[model samples]
Target: MIYKFCPAVLLLILSFSPGNLFFSETKNVKEIAKVIKTSSETNEEAIYNSLNSNQFALPQLESFKEALKGFYILKEKGLISKNILTLIDFSMSSNSKRLWVIDLTTNTILYNSLVAHGRNTGNEFATSFSNSPQSFKSSLGFYATGEIYSGKHGNSLKLDGLEKGINSNARERAVVIHGAEYVSNSFIQNNKRLGRSLGCPALPLELTDKIIQTIKDKSCLFIYFPSDSYKGASKLIS
Candidate 1:
């Protein structure tokens, strides 16, 4: 005489209801995750091999692996939305194309370009990091992309930091991805490094709009550095 919904019924509905799964059953997100406890090393090797075969740089393989680990952790904790991920490898020189926007569904790189760190971070390399408003330094760890808007820098993408004590002051610091003339090949050729931003991961003017459009809403962004502090303090990755 009455309708009742229990835990098992809810799970069943979540698992088998029509249009419940965003990805196809043949290759779903969880299947790609491979989060088994005993198979961690095996999974890491598979991921590394896959990344290499997909044209990602061999030098950045370690960072790529760490990014995947963070992605899996956040995905399991329900902190991510889409399969697309944007990774900015600050460990590389500013003259290099260290920013990568990857499509996890197809395991391909959609965009690879140069990205700028904070002005106060360094000259040709980003060394120091911060999460304060006036620090004028880049922050490390995972970030969830937010809404897009047209601001002083034309079209900009917002970011919400997900790590405590690592990058949680992103909103207060106003670290959005926007275009700048300094983040270009001309600037790098002239100065031997990409132009620095005011603590924002500024992109080149040509690819700004397209990159922002692709990774704008609910995508994952990981600003990676091999700092001991980040490795120890980042709850999202560590």
Candidate 2:
């Protein structure tokens, strides 16, 4: 008489077959991991595309990509608590609106305003960076937004540098984010460039409070510059 096994039994038998008809546990795990990584990449790509299509200006694609990578890494490490990313593209001229505060959850650009680099960073472009106090040069890398407080700049946001040696001295250097009168279009029009800060990423006076409020409290901030040394040294991005 002919007999048939249930599907479950058949599957069990196939799982032990010499040819390995069914995936081994290791292979299954790897496949699942692959799927998860692919899904994550797809999601990142979607967000990038959405943000790129916005009507307002955006940071350069490469700069945004690096910043996004660091942002997710920081989020994964529990270093960032908010779904906000503030990007200062020091690669662009100070006259340009290179500071972009983006709401990552909504894939929207909340603020795209002019920002000033360090006094020693460069004239029109930020060509120099530092992690030293009194260097008066901006530091490039990832930072975590800290508590808000009123300082000499009125309302300001603190920044805790994430990458050691790259920007870890942010706190000691008093490199906070604040509004400055010289970080405006009018200043640029008159001076041919935005005024430089001591070492802070100063924003337009009108936008300082709002931008700080939106990105403060454990959000990610990335000051991007296409430098080979920084790219290789930054553990968050490298």
Best by lDDT: 2
Clashing pairs in model 1, backbone N/Cα/C closer than 3 A: none
What digit string (tens of lDDT, one per residue) describes model 2 on residues 87-129? 8898888888888889887888888989889999899988889
How many clashes in each candidate?
Answer: 0, 0
Which model scores highest in TM-score?
A: 2
Q: Give Cα-based local distance difference scores for all models.
A: 0.82, 0.85
Model 2 stretches astray by more than 4 angstroms: 1-43, 52-54
Compute the lDDT for candidate 1: 0.82
RMSD for each of the candidates: 10.1, 8.2
